[model samples]
Target: MGGFHRFYPNACDLRSLPVQEVDESVSVQEGQRLLQSGLLGGILLRVDDVYQVILSSDLAGEEGNQPLKTKAWRPALFIHARMPVAELLEQWMKTPDAVPVVADEHGVPQGVIDPLTSAGVLHHEFTRIRSYLDSILAQVNECICGIDDRHKVVIWNSKAEELYGYKAEEVLSKRIENFFSNLRITNCMHENKELKGHYHQPTEGTHVLISAAPVTHGSAVIGGISVEKDITEVVQLNQELTRASSQVKLLEQEIKKMSGQECAFRHLTGRSAVMQELIRFGKKVSTTDATVLLRGESGTGKELFARAIHQNSNRYMHPFIVVNCGAIPNNLFESELFGYEGGAFTGADRKGKPGMFELANEGTLFLDEVGEMPVEMQVKLLRVLQEGSFYRVGGSEPVQVNVRVLAATHRDLEAMISRRQFREDLYYRLNVVSLEIAPLRERREDIPELVHLFVQEFCQKYGKSITKIEPAVMTSFLDYSWPGNVRELKNAVERLVVLTEGETITEQSLPENLRRNTYISLVTTPAAQGNLMNVAVEAEKQLILKTLQQVKGNRSEAARVLGIPRSTLYYKLRQLGIPAKG
Candidate 1:
């Protein structure tokens, strides 16, 4: 049999690797001492100018027997000292039990690069890579979390601690659901799939957009990783909007009539011509059983409009049920919309409960966030609308129901139809009477009234006696873009009413973003002296500063939420004389 040597020149250099060398004349006792001292992993020897490597095993029981010699000590496999570390590793892997000796061109022993040394090197490299990954995760602005196949928390970054209010030390090795029961990491791990852009509320008062995927090892899933973007502010704003919209609805219902024309739509408040026209159209549609689609952005009071339509309809006295299509899980859509029979599936109600269609029988069914409805459910809904009847889950008999379907959404159904996400048949069915409610920005004329309404509502609720809002504050309200629409405005008013100590709400009580955004109006102020450029620069600086503060000095997150590139944010920071640290 012939022995062969392998080498890879550029793979890795073995020259820097530590090796063990000793003269062949060393006694067995000395070799044992060297091995026990841990100064050398393996010993290299030169016998008759030929190299031999001796591991600790070779010296076993030889201490009291005789002096180390060619016949007594095992001759380990040998390689050239100049061989690349790749070849060394390959040799070690192929012959794991054999220690290797590195020798010169003249066959003189240089040193031994044994299995123990290679393992130590690999462990060191792994630690370095792990440390690098940890540092990278720390800098990321979004929350990053990971769980192993055992369903234990394995990785929790700094942002995760900030968002979820749990430290890595406290959560590591614990079941993920113990802290964030709403997190879908376990689901991803079990299903071995990915879920992105999912709206999640990990804990009360904390809302996030989560994207999670299974971490796989070839054909097997080893773990799961999730990234969550905090959207608590946006969600809170929308919630505030919903509350304010509800308050407005309540107030309108209290009034006997609003100029007689808005008697039916008193719940839908707006003095603008567009709003009045929309109200008139809503009232006209409310008299019939036509399927009406309320189109508007979130927090624009789409549900309120639907209720007004339902209340004014002939079946106003019947049951009016509201279903948020976006909030329902896809798997439960069928059972939720069309009631399931007893023992329909596992964990089902023994006695089938009525679905939205059955509950809203003979009345109006308001489907909010209809665009978020699954494509499969859209066909079923279309059939119900067209046939005026549908079968329940796990039932053979057809159930009849008279439901005036009123659909509302903040998404563009036309675009979704083009993308084939939404059905055109359903769109046509629901679009019999389409009303596009104007956003707060477009109907800025109604700000004062809406502000007055929200202030009174919040003031009465919070037990505050705030009666007046400063003109400047109101101007800021009008000038500032209400991205959350009426909801954002309502939230701002509520915030001011709660925070303000006096009877009057002032600019100082305004939220930081609201005040900073109104800087464009500063040019009109007496102190500005018409310095538009200065006013603009100061506004930009304040906006950047506020954004940075909101993100807790994370510039990357600030840039992302502000809809600007990270480099652009940095440039603006420099141009505006702000620190670049965060």
Candidate 2:
């Protein structure tokens, strides 16, 4: 009763069958009519709380006036309403009755169970299970092939069809060894052992990693099953990566050789006092794993400073990853910064991916245009900065990374904090050691050196031999306000080096804006109404001072700018009593 309790009152409902009740006096013809009306089995008689089962076959040959109880009928089998449906079926199967009466604990008739209804439920459940398994198998990328005891292929999935270039229909009944020579399916079956992680290249001309296991039935090996993964692209990528790594090593060696006599921060070239001070501070910070914030205008070489700091640090051998916060779409920002697990989204990689923080582990992560990062992301970033750990998108595990963060931005973060556009805690976290880069116009004294370096770089790149820059061109460069900073100067120098035809770049090679601005400055400034010699000398002194400022007190460049011999410029400086360095 305990086992049959769940099915008691409505055992017929378990198989979705209907119940038919009858009294002892009910005619056999009436029971036949009830069975024909769709009751698979009918109840014959009820005495004291027990109902007798009368099957359709028992009333088949009986006369119309004969009572059903007079024909063959089994003793009533009673079950409680709380009895299990499966346990009721088991007990019913042991009896001669085709149906079992269901009742509640109070002894009231509920329903009965019919065998036909039970079969329908099992069929539907098995079909659904088969469909679910088929869907999973069809979508899997690895090739799976199985053979039966006769060595004939019994299972060949879609991925197997794609990998071996054979349809499932062509291989279903075929012997696996006859079609695939390198599969070793026969050996696995005969030896009853597994072949794991074996690299194979079959005559069909495909690189695959194969693993095979013997299928067993009782104590005997029946056949074999094999899983194959295509790795041709992976192998090719590994070869290319090896070559790239070798080239990087050679480049590193060359850089080290060139930097043997110079400091690691030698690329930051300038004689300006502000430039020197920034360099000194950067060198000091690079020795430790400190979070640094670089504040500067666009194109002012903030990324360059970040790289210089990374290269001079103890973590130089590790990665220096740059994340452009502004370039990423807002919706994809979290996934891009923190990565995601497989199936995290529709287009995510199956094997999952490592995020920027994970990739920059034991290294440095430079967040360029950090101010453009969304407000919500700022809170997450602040937590990562404080905790040194973060969870991946759609993930639960916290990943720890020992990375030094360097953030750069052109926007005013202080104003952003007031507006609630940037997080205050994140601001303090990133600004642990803030450094500012002065704009090109503010440090005009660095232009001549910067120009020389850019020209030399581009000349070598373009296979040119240009070495000298015309003094008029230098004077014009110093006169203009460079709104685009050092990046703009580098581009202009590259253009001049590529287009100029002579060893010395002439003033005509300068951009039209620079030339026009110099001409306007000269024409607009009023001159004294006096002797021509006096006005010309005054103009010469002004030009000399501008040139000195441009070249950062480099006398040779100043003399060249004035179109006077170096000795003559020195003599005139002493005669005119103008400080030569200024």
Top TM-score hit: 2
lDDT for position 541 in model 2: 63
Estimated TM-score for each candidate: 0.47, 0.53
Local accuracy of candidate 1 as per-residue lDDT tens digits, 1-582: 012522124223333233466665678887788788766656666677655567777777764535556433445667776666665666766766656666678965556654455666666666876877788798988999889988798999999888877899999999887766655888887887899999988788888898999998658898999999999999889999999999998777555243333454677777778998898888888888889999998889998888888777777668989999988999999999999999999998999877899999999899999999999999999999999999999999999999899999989889999999999999999999899989988987677668878888988999998755655576677678899998888888888988999877888888888887786466665645656677656555655665566456888866654556789888988887898893
State the weakest 10-residue window (summed lDDT) of model 1: 1-10
On a 0 to 1 TM-score scale, where does candidate 1 land against the true structure? 0.47
How do the residues 1-582 of candidate 2 rate in per-residue lDDT, one tens digit apiece?
234322123344454344566667778787777888764545547655556777676677676677677774577677776665566766877885445666767966666555577667656655876786588669888888889888899989999888778998899998877786745777888888899989878645477888988898657887888888899788778889999999999998677555622456788878789999999899889888889999999999999899999988878878999999999999988988899999888989998999999999999999999999999999899988889999998899999899999999999999999999998889999999999999988887788778888888998899988867766677677778888889888888998999999788988888899888876665556763456665545555666776777666778867765556899879978876788664
Model 1 misplaced regions, further than 4 Å: 1-263, 524-582
| C-alpha local distance difference test of each model | 0.78, 0.79
